[model samples]
Target: MRWMQRTWIGSTITLALTMLFLTGCPKRPDVVETVPRPMAPQGEVGMPTPPPLPKVAIPEEKSPTEVAAQPSEAKPTTEAGAVPEAKIAEAEVKPEPSAEGKAAAEPELALKDIYFDYDQSAIREDSKKQLNENIEWLRKNLAGKVTIEGHCDERGSSEYNLALGERRARATRDYLTAAGIGADRISTISFGKERPFALGHDESAWKWNRRAHFTPSAK
Candidate 1:
């Protein structure tokens, strides 16, 4: 009987000790269940994709003939007070010389003759006046050239008259050269007894024949 009682108390104590140890230990965390979200609608995951735009067709290029058929841009018209371009061009271009201008360009009068004493090459005092008049004309018309034609009376021999006439022409030319006329501008020529100014053998005829005449040349 005493042994039975001691076993029972010892067993009771052991069971109580086991219960206290289990109570002192830490508890484990509780487990939670996870649920998956419903899948998004087919096109709504991010931004909805825009529907494809309808394609537009480009027109073909026109032919050159079709382009030419189009109306041209209008040109500006001249104002009422404005002058035409053609008239302005004509006005800018100078007109040719008139009849009056042509007439004025030519020399108006001829030079006077210079008479000399019979068979003499010396220029007379009266002839000097004529030469002065010629000089004035020459100065005005600088381009003019002259030939000094010396003549003789029929009384002298042809050869002698020719030689004398040349002397007279040379003397006349020398006088002109001394008076500022260029030597190149004055030319001398002798028309002997073969060509006489007056037909008769009298002093009047000889006086007229023994003279120096001025003839203009173009050169």
Candidate 2:
């Protein structure tokens, strides 16, 4: 009976030691579940892809340079009928021929006036020099035609002075026609006791009024 009691006691102690060993060791921590990260798109099975790159521009190769034209060598502008620039420049610079055998420019007056005595239609000796000068001027301007105006002082009857003025104009015309001026190129008019020059009633005014005046005739 004592050997059984001892065997029972040994079994109880062995069970108590196993329970203490299991309680004495530290406990393992609780396992945590991790969230998955976002990923780039897959091109194939495993590799991820980026955005496409822009196209690159390549420069073209240049052609070889040709020989330049010389300075003296001018190119043709038109067909064979066209005149060259050099010839045109020459024509522009070339001087023209002047009028042959022409005299110098005409004098400003071309012809001069002649004075006469009161109540006389005769040409005076002093008046001869001026009359010759008028003839020379008329000859120079061959295209020129003239009219002789006979003016008189405010004296005598108007009718009498008009007759005298006509006589004076005719006498002057006769002198010019005889001196080689054309008869057709000469004309005579009488303004008797009218168109006085000096404006007073003296001999000085009368001498200037009684004269032959010349003017260019209209064509």
Task: After superposing candidate 1 on the true structure, give the runs of residues whose Cα lies further than 4 Å from its correct spot.
Answer: 1-109
User: lDDT tens string, model 2, 1-219?
Assistant: 999999999999988998898899877878898879667466856765777889889876555442333245777568778887889999899775443312234243555667778789998888878889888888978988888888889899899888888888788889998998999988888888877878998887888888888777864
TM-score of 1: 0.51
TM-score to native of every candidate shown? 0.51, 0.50
State in Å the error of residue 1, model 1: 99
Q: After superposing candidate 2 on the true structure, give the runs of residues whose Cα lies further than 4 Å from its correct spot.
A: 1-108
Cα displacement (Å) at residue 112, model 2: 1.7
Report the number of the highest-lDDT candidate: 1
Among all windows of 10 consecutive residues in model 1, the one with the lowest summed lDDT is: 102-111
| Model 1, span 68-146: residue lDDT tens | 9999999999999999999999999978877667545654345778888877889889889889988888888798899
